[model samples]
Target: MKKLKILILLLTAAISVSAQGFEHFVTAKGNQLMDGDEPMRFFSWNIPNLNYVEDEMEFGRTNPYDLPTEFEMRDAFETVKRMGGTVIRIYTIPVRNTDFPEDAVTFVEAPGEFNEEAFKVNDMMLALANEYEIRIIFSLLNNWPWMGGRPNYAAFRGKDKDEFWTDKQLIKDFKKTVEFTVNRTNTITGVKYKDDKSILCWETGNELESPYSWTKEIAAYVKRLDKNHLFMDGFFAIDGRTTVMRESLADPNIDIVSSHHYEPNPIKMMKHIDNNLRVVKGQKPYIVGEFGFASTKGMEAVMQKIMAEKDIVGGLTWSIRYHHRDGGFYHHSEPLGNGIYKSFHYPGFHSGLVYDEKDFLDMYRRYAFEIRGMEAGVDEAPNAPKLLEIVESHDIRWQGSAGASGYHVQRSESAEGPWEVIGYNVSDAAIQTFANFHDESAELGKSYYYQVLATNQGGESEPSNVVGPVVYEYQALVDNWVNYGKAFDSKDIELVTGDDRSFKEITSRAKGKKGSEMLYHVEGELVGFKVYAFEENPDTSSLKIEISGDGERWNEADTQTEVYASKEKNYAYQVPKFYQVSEGENIRYIRISFQDVAQIARVELLYK
Candidate 1:
């Protein structure tokens, strides 16, 4: 027993050291690869591990019992090949043991047994990849709702199960999993799989950084694994520049920079792209690993323009499976079922490329098909906006719409690049009227570029002037606030006046919920105060409030006045109401709250 234990320990140590020694280098042609080869542009389906198999099985009509079967993988790979896809992305972390209860492999700890079912499935997948000439980008770490450990006795965990950055048990489980994958040569029908040219890359994790710390540990660990495949990590570029990219690239183990872009406007999406490119500075290769096109307008043209550029490798849309839980919209082919695929419960997410009998291939053809390549270089010159045209300005607005939601304008002096967020349409003027804003502060004699984007109910509109880069130097920062999700409730307005004694900043309270209130602090003199309520909707019924001076002497705003509907027939009240100052003037503190019990929508404030 002691000799056997020593052998196992030595083997484990050998695996860890083997994983850490490899270094990544670029090919002469500038493609980012593990062994310095061109990455074959491919499309892949993200198959969840044993734990998530049930969700996919039940909702997506996949049969996990036959998952490792040769015929099943061959059929799946063939289908993908028919759709022009060249790769498959398989998940390694199983979410819940229940997702595959009948299966022999389990992440849960039982005794001294090991469940090698995951390894078996992976072997089948690799065989399929070899058969179909499709590459595989396997994710190593456990993702989302699953914890990791041993077989029948593994430590299965997710982000919530353990602190992603500091969980020791989870880390150890991952290290073991990697060792198992690297040391074991996969077998499909008695054939060994290793050092195969068909395996494209080894991805570190899928969609990491819900808070941004997971990447550091996971990236480092992956570097300690097999050196044969290029290491990639997934990231979402939502706000700010690529702060996360800078941190990830600092570790030498990371081979290529990858990110997901989903902005409404082509120009806006390009902003993220440009920002990422600037940070990378071409030291390594970069790719927009994941980007999506809703049945919308902007991205098609944007993609067409990008297809003409050489630096970009390619991007994977969302999921490749024609399943319902993921809103199965078929991009490359038509749906196989008629009334066969329908959401049994929540139906809001319709993100699939093919939907019931519909031939949605045109959508894919419109963007991905006709793409060609061109050299990459920026020309620095007139830094001003061109074709600065407004597509559609609307009187009404809603969240996530092209003409209805919001607008954004950007300016850059170099024209070659480095565009800055000059202004956004969230300003009081832009919200009220979709008008052009001219930044008089723009310095003369220097070139500038500018572009305007409109967002309405569907999403942001395609940026108007995408043909040429726009230039602008003069700009201003607009001050405004918006209702984030829901209208303010009565409890939110009335609860504040009771006993709180400090001059509290109301921004935190108003966050997430929508309503209007005075933004500037009223610090000086106060002879009278009024709450301006806008009767924007008909459902509003009541209002609530609280007042305080010196953080004491709390008095509630008149509940009667707050409860009244709009002076108009609608429940909303846009007019302001005057309230007499109960204290002897020189009011240093004022807190008035308003909530519409009936159908509160928009509110404002008027004070003197």
Candidate 2:
């Protein structure tokens, strides 16, 4: 009886450990990544906004830099899982730049100071990574000024950009960042980041253009601090430098060697990959850290080369952006090679047809499974979407599901009962910065509850949380730049149409110079007006709205607008401004003058 009791206790302890601990940590074994006994290979994506964001250019939002919410982090992981991706590389941890706004949030506030709130955001991401069974490669810094990096560090000490590679104080400051990140404990899961298995490796930086001395120093420091995770050499411009690459592979501290390939020609890209592979074939694992923006066939050819080469571990596409917690997917327009390809969303959409987005995504999904020697099958149903807000009978927005391609909106008289489908196969990606579906057939006098179901190739999700009892009262004169002269007229303004590549709508911009104006004629009494405007540089651009009973005379309307700015050069950040009319006032015409270069996306005139 005592022996039996001992066996029972031992079994219980084993079960407890199994339940609490992760299965395995990814380890390096002679040019291959191993997950326990099996080799690990992945065809994944670079999720730049995983830890920090540079592309939160949404409508009505002033600040672009934001910490990812739990909903957003989960959506990213879930999307990776559905894509059959086992790994993702997050962009660098951000540092403060002198050019940023004083109120901007970043991970490293000063040399030794850190932002706890930003680190908490990373904590949630690591927790969700473990839950979703996906691995992460955490890049430590950036080479460019998009987010602060070596130059910023140099600026901190009043040194030149190249001095970052040689200056002792600048290097020490960078090491402080590394040590803080590696030694910190996750606040949510009670696991120290150094000991967590979710991290696949620690990259020195994103495309660092440093000398061998700096690379060797940083690699040694990272390996000394964290023994569990592997180290990757994040050198920039991998243009067939086999001798330099061979030397990097020989370093004991550097466990992985990677290259970023943006070559448009598939033949040249393959040659470069082959040369790099030959240098590190049996010494260490090699990966194409970032690759894409080629023709569909060109990209396919490059992916095929990676799969054919046994020594090459895997490749991560340039990037993939996910749905925002607010409503729509985060977007970034790559301003290279004709500036056509934007960041890709899952399951593809019609707006991205110029880049063969749907076909390329389909090919990626197939190759993701093929590289693992598994057959691509049906995916699971997406999680239920969240109905965000209902402005009126026509304007309804919702937070989109991760892998969902389209949505089904249903309506009913009561909150709980039989529902009728009002929208079928409505795409959330059709609209940019927000996911919306219009109820064109809603009765004028009826108040009804509404719910949404997300759908894809797999299946349909359960109904979303009910939102409603919205009554159609006032008819809003909504002009999404489509009805230009019907309800509004403009002076020195040009209606820009066609594939703008950012939003699926028309826009009107100043033609020659500043002081271009738009005049809207309202039929009935005006309650208020909401205007969506885009400014490349909000610091230099201004929009003034005025009201008038007669076209000749005008008075400045009392307006409420948010202050907007961005560090991005030539990025058209968007924000909405609202102007309320005084009660019992005879207001019929509204005039808006644009200062500097500004574009208007939409205007809604509410009337009684």
Candidate 3:
């Protein structure tokens, strides 16, 4: 069996190399991707929803703000360029969910049925990518059924989801989708799909949990269709990624080894990098197809190691958020924090939002240059300090972290203001006193907002927790809020103080479920609520609003009463909707969720 495998590999290698006849092609030399002789090491990320459309289907999972526009693609590619990225991974197939058949707007509606309208989405994507001079790693299939995945295809063939991994009939049917996509013409650009230089490679699937032999079959099949591009396995580096990569690389059809890393422990992330380096040392060219942070811990360390390794081609972050998308500001992958902005699938290209974005962009820019064998970049991003105390209208105090070289302060008169830096190097002892920075400019008669950010060589971290137009003495306090009950974790309501329900506040976007109501206790009576919200799909979602006192029971008059949102409240909305609680009725607790998928932009409780 071993001898037969070796014999097959040799023949496959000869065929793949000779079949290449394109202007730009990517081939793997040991531990390096070379374009003929010029090495290709990339800094990249994934836009799983690149060829996406809001056809009222959840084929591509969306957020409150979805980037389903063609210009959004332009904005995304521009962002990639700005971040110093040259390549990106995009999902070519929109896996259909069996549960929502109406939402099945995929390349293949049924087996062998090519949807031209749907496939045109890919045409536009490639055209846009070509314009940007950015390359794509198109993921052809998915392991999960969220997007009409392997199971959807298998079920269409009258087989179980598990059958997709081993059944020949199922595999053959999947290959049809591959053959169709690999050969389809890009009508928009007047170019053949297989001839497009925008495509870097075709991944077998996204995070497949199938057998090693199955990946070999698909990888081999994709190679026969398009020899111009390399192939990769979607095997996540969790249990036996190293071993599976070795096994997959043995097939000459498989040109690159792709691994995923999401370890939060700095030590584990560091170790993962070392092992990835060791595994691909003399064997195959490797790239971390995906690595990300749900939070800020250990991410810098992980990035530092990935960038430092010479053998590793480069790493791609989990995703890039596009403009005007469904999810609000960022993906809800982890607890939303300063640097923990879903590791960079930013929601939109809209400017003026105070995301410590420069620091994030700087990190990628530096590493992108690093992979190209070029020396570039300045300071690593510093850690943001925690705001400890607000001494009324006078001094603002905070605590610094190890990574930050200094801290900068900005004060605003309103939530949306022309902010000015009040202090710099506040955390740097040599430059100024650490932690305690006096706001000499604070005026007692007017309200003032402040933002504190930590800075280092790479850039500045996200603003501190106490970003404020902080209310001074009983100016309707919005402090003390928590996630009472919800399907997903949301930010504290106190993070939202201003009337502007923009994307910056962590509490802006919250989720609700069918028949599940969320609870929250505010410091004051809820005279009214300004729930800036919208349905993911108005047709599928509905609103249910109710309030309570002490969070246990409903208003004194009615326990089951609900204030259904008016027609105008379905999509774009304004602030608080007041409810007459009848004199002395409890209005301290706000209970709101939905009958289906929904987004709470900014939950504001009006104190009487």
Candidate 4:
């Protein structure tokens, strides 16, 4: 019996040591995230709703979203574990529902009290993460009020939302919550929550636009209680250029440089990564904590190459949603779904809506694995495109390269000798549509040799087949183009629209929902629409564009899929403007409802 007891004690010690060692707690080592001697690299997921629960009837929340059952939570983590995912980023705080307008369930229920159920759910979340060997980054708060964020926190202290950073009492209250959360004993492991190894880092909040001092203070507070884990400043490029980025990068307590990206242009996306990498300056590793497009687009290669070449720590896609609960592959997300989805859910892809679908998750896995050092065959030499036209003049068209960003249309006097750049950045188009390129240098009907080469971040592809001694002529893109007057011109269109009141008199509200007036009259095959934001960029989550006929019943537009607002105010450059063919029934009224009342700029419609 003595021998058996001694053996059992040895095994327990070994187990404890193993967990501690693997917590491997990552630290920045000259731009590389290192764990012990082995470099720490990962492909992770941003699961904003991992701990979300159906609003308990007593909370007065009336949240329509369903919470994942304990079993579902296990399955979710298990699936991530199987998919080569090393980390799971989850939201630890749930705040007010900005859209529906209600109280929300939060880890910190009040000034000094913690929600019993919320904590229990987190205990389960941490345990499951530990069981699956997945590390977690817990975000403590939110920027927007959707999750009862800063606003809710301040309201609880009887202070204005902006006072969250400066109010001494409020800051102290924040420390109390932080102390309780980090020091609280885990119900599952019997180990204190802060001491557990499953947690990777503590984030101050989700893209919060708060003061840098507040972040430093909170991070200091957290470190005082639990010195084991790393800290992250949830600094986002929202509002105008501010000290947020500099403060975050220079802060000693913050361990990682995290930037969220949503740019569609590949060139811009790569640059965004570069900008983030530049700030780290080798003192810390960087991660694109969030980024997304409806599809792989052409990122499979760009992301893998940059991560490996730049020695980036890792990337967490915008989100992963429960297959069964959050609407399947084809389910519509908030702002309402666009009969067809691009995979980003309603909330966090900027406006919080990030969920799953079969193809989308598979794409996520493809990039995830690629980022983890798996070889993806995206760098192979692209096949030479077959030039669709034999042209010697300025106007020309050709096939697109499979993995190319743009093409170089070259001009040569000989069929086999030298080629000069006639045009470049000729955009890549769909497989079925030929790319159009023009050379202003070409004389009409001139005999010239032309060959095109595909270009991408990877490198240039083999020159396309030569098309020579061909004559070409300029083709006008449009004939007799006319600018129809704005939506205010009632005589030019069927509907006369105004919001709440005349556009000039309206004062924009940063919070709560604002609405646009209805334009009613007649209807033509309502062809397309153009719109932009007015002044300061609005919150991406706060906008609704609906078409109502008879000034009564209404339907939302597909373009609304992209809210005019983004977490980064300037990324939106101008208001959200788009032109698309209208679907559904013809309506008499057009109305728009969204947050950020001041963001509206202009709206115009075109019809024949």
Candidate 5:
């Protein structure tokens, strides 16, 4: 059997090398990770790796750590395959032996102490990977919870960063574990499984180096043991200096440069990838080891853009286990316990291909197949227009999917290249279009660009083509006052301060329709008081101001604050600190009587 396995590996190696056609690793001059071969996208449904298999037992008697029966493993594997997934990343490294009477067993490969039960679990996972003919990236170490196969060991927990870097024994055990897995083949199942390409890659750890590292010992160890298989030293682009992470990958031992891409801003991710690519000396394949669309601001659009680029070999979203009731990744919903980790459904992994409860899979099934080297359909983009134009006051709009939450509309003077975004606006369902502005700031005569994007519950749509004559002029300043008018006074009631003692003490029963006085609480360390008014009136350049601290001490009539009334329609007044009340003083009413009649609407008080 060993001899037969050797022969198969030799043949497979020859085929793989020859089929590559191009260089072995990514190069700097051309595209990085991707080359002649069609890029392959990988997806992983990571189990948080905190709950031990023993803890997950149906009954205490039956050892749950044993490998899932072949039937069960196949069922799980086939589900992912059906969902159009090409790979799976599992967190199966065991952390403890509860039966041990001494200190909890911490090492993944303790000297002579081997856990057959734990091995069985991993064996099933690998066997299933082969059976389904899907690639697998076995993460060598799970996150903080189950570090190096120890249950709840503080040394491995996320917060205990010091030990993982400093502990000599822990480092030794980690190296041994990788050595054991890469060297030992699974023959216990009597399956003809050997080192197959289906076992695509091995990851050092998931989201490692976030807390910072004192040593590169773990990476060094993997390089020494598995020279044949590629090493994906994990990185989370969220916290680390991306340049540093890319530099770490430059080590001769590291075969693939891997990083996790999770940013709300699409442009940020673009800049990040570009920056990291700068120092990666020669050409080396870079992988966004994991990324996802759940709560990940612009995931879908970003992924679509990145994947379309021929340079990016392939990338993986968070997971395939859409129904991990036990939870997974940065965000996880409920899990489906029906003997399967359902991908689609409420509360499951939001990043699954199939809905856990419903059979609905993403329409991008064709895209998935394409990544795996299958013939695919021509890019069938919907007939959404490339550009849209609207008058200055009107909104630019469009209808799109339920997954779109909002769109970004960018504008530029030139129709050809660089564009600056005026603002990112929301999709107003009431208007039936994703709307945005080229407001009063928009210039007339000059062609200004306009675009609309549909946004949904999941993500945003691509921007539309630039549109516009998109005129912007003062929309007939007809009753410009009425246009921006607001009133704070009424004929029926008058705002008054009964006495001078009422200074700064706003009293109710003094004012407009309901006679409800709006009081300003000058509490705490407040410095001063300010009142704002909005109006859109014409022919008014000056206004008479009235002041009454406590309504009784009327300072007659004064022209304190003035306005050119410009073409805009807002006015403000700062009630002087001299009019301010002490802790014991009772200050009140303030009234503004315009000497030149102008329209006024809405009023506000601001702290200075």
Candidate 6:
């Protein structure tokens, strides 16, 4: 009788724990994703910066990849919630590359060595997902070398990239990564990652071009370590192939299959989705893990097909970037689109006009709610913006609110008290690289505390963090490229416009090639001037600046300009050089000559 009672108690305890585990996780049920007992479907986004950031393009910052702060993580989650999204597929966890700077941060520092600090950020990401009731599809590795990927893993053993799949030593090193990630405990929640409900699935890698043999072994390994979460095969070819391998479909360990669609043709994209749906019919749930960079109509057509198909569980847009903790949105000009479309932000902005970002996001929000069989009600007021820095009266920057359309700048004599409105209805979207509002009305010599309130169609957010005691120093003439001819005289300069970090507007910059020169007519007693230049290669590019009292006689300004060259070659590098003039130099005209292709974003001339 005693033995019988003990056996029954043990069985009941195991059942209870199993039941609790299934309550929150997303499970696969033969072509359907189940949330508890109901089917789960969503139209969502891919947030690449959810864990690690690669777009930290702040001025003078050498290294780009850093662990995102809690503020940044929360902002991304909140943006997804506002967009009516339930799931967000984050980019792959970073691995350290041999060529990376010694100080560069990566999640997998070595074969079995994980960075605790990097993983802590990931823990916070999962914790936020749980708090926000959002599900995450965490990718484990990368096939591309954007952040360290398969090549880096192979390099560790001094083997070729192809060996990562077939080599025994390389496979062992990868499995160790899998085991560590699956069994690691979340510092905040004190729950193992395998048991966390916030994770929707664990993708093998980001758009990996892995062979079937490697995926099968890795998928089984992941399932062995994690029985609660579903495993997704991340094998994909960039050539717009939509069908999953038969080997992947037959594997018991692979619970979900996905395909990436970048086909610009709407009919082709839909046809591809249908082909995958037919292939995975009744075997496992299928998802369009990533898709976009098509026309608004084309993307809408793809979304319609995903929603209409019973077997297609969900689809995430190519990507969405959120507000950076330091201030402004993390910008990535998608090279695939020829640098025309940047990653979409919540509620959209004019910066993404070429890609129909505003219209597409609206469509995404509507579809995101519709697919879930729910109505998207009125959006709430945006969260408060963070006041990042007050460079000067003319150069004010802040971290943008997710859904905010514009901002109102207020000034106060003291930190806490009666404030005066200095600037109203200022658009942060007018500029790229940073969210800026020039306080032109700020009087010289008057030191005042400043705060900003973000506004949108929904409502206004609370005041941003206070930046104070800023004394207006000089009356400055700032040209940000919009009115190019008004500030500088150069016909050889071409006005290049699009979603590029090099071009700043509200004033846009001038693009100059070799033998091109621009002359700026200085209106005031020139104190000093700072030139913001974007050079592709500083080693080969040179810009000469000379001052002339008379239009004929010119003297070169004796100043050395140091521009930090980044290792990443995809984006344009900003080289901001400041030249100081002695107190009483009668300078009338400033001439700038470009020796190589370069973009001059802005020129700030400081004067009394």
Tell me, by lDDT, which candidate is best: 6
lDDT tens readout by residue for model 4, 1-608? 99999998898667555544254665667667766687767776777667874211111112333445565576467557545678988865664333432333456667777777777788888877777878888888777665557776788766788888899987877777777778877676655778777788888888877777888888888888888888877877521232137666677788776777665556666676776656666667677776655345545544664556665778776555432321111111222122223323211121122223433444555666666667433344444555656542323666444434467888887888588987775643211011155455665445678888877555788888888776544311210111223232122122212231122211121122354332423344344454433334433434555665566677777764333222221111223322232553565455545444434333434322
- What are the lDDT scores of the predictions, listed in order? 0.40, 0.78, 0.59, 0.56, 0.42, 0.79
Candidate 1 global lDDT: 0.40
lDDT of 6 at 269: 82
Q: How do the residues 427-455 of candidate 2 rate in per-residue lDDT, one tens digit apiece?
A: 77666654366676676678889999999
Tens digit of per-residue lDDT, candidate 5, span 1-608: 99999999898667544433223232222234322254445433433322222212111111222233343344345545654566666654555433332333333434335565556556666655655666666676655443333222324334254465556665555555667766665544332222444455676666665333422566666656655455665654541255436456546655566666555456777666566556454356666665543332354455565566554555665443221121111112222212222223211222232333222234344445656666534322222223334653434443332223245566777666477766564422211011223243454456666665544333455667667545553221101111122233334334432221111111111222322232223222222223322223323422333444454465533333323222111112112111122122232334544433222222322111
Estimate, for each residue in 1-608, the C-alpha lDDT of model 3 and write its tens digit. Answer: 99999998888656433333334767777868877688887777777666763222111122222225565576577657656678889754864445543433556677788778778778888888877878888888877664457878888878888888888888888888899999987777666677777788888878787788888888877877787888887775652344336687677888787777666556776676677666666577778787765233355566667667767788787666543322112223223233334334321211212433435555566677766676555535745556655645433566543345467888888767677898876532211111145565454456777777877656889887756656553212221122334222232222222322222222334445566455556564544454444443433334555666666676533322223322221123222222222323456666665566554543434443
On TM-score, the candidate that comes out on top is 6
Candidate 3 wrongly placed segments (more than 4 Å): 1-23, 53-67, 239-243, 294-297, 325-358, 373-506, 509-608
Model 5 spans > 4 angstroms off: 1-69, 97-112, 146-161, 189-194, 210-216, 239-244, 264-275, 278-282, 293-297, 322-360, 373-608
Tens digits of per-residue lDDT for model 1 on 107-156?
32322223566557766666556666666666655444333322212334
TM-score against native, each model: 0.45, 0.87, 0.60, 0.54, 0.45, 0.91
Ranking by lDDT: 6, 2, 3, 4, 5, 1
The alpha-carbon lDDT assigned to residue 270 of candidate 4 equals 69
Alpha-carbon RMSD of each model: 22.4, 4.4, 13.7, 17.7, 22.4, 4.3
What TM-score does candidate 2 reach?
0.87
Candidates 1 and 5: which is better by lDDT?
5
Question: What's the number of clashes in each of the models?
Answer: 69, 0, 27, 27, 51, 6
Q: Can you tell me which runs of candidate 4 are displaced by over 4 Å?
A: 1-23, 54-62, 65-67, 96-105, 238-244, 323-360, 374-608
Q: Which stretches of model 1 miss by more than 4 angstroms?
A: 1-52, 55-69, 95-114, 146-162, 189-194, 210-221, 235-244, 264-267, 322-360, 363-608
1-608 per-residue lDDT for model 6 (tens digits): 99999998898656434423235688888889999899999999898878988877665566667888888888898889999999999888788886665678998888999899999998898888887888999899889777788998998888899888899999999888888888988787766789888899999998888899999999988998989999998988333554777688899999998988887777888877777767777688988898887889888888888888888899998789877665667777676864555788778777677788888888889999999999887678887888866867777888778778778889998999598988787766666654477776667788889999998888999998898888876767777776665566785888766545543211256788888988777666677776777776656546888888776898887655767666554345465433344433887677788878887777777765
**lDDT score, candidate 2, position 303:** 88
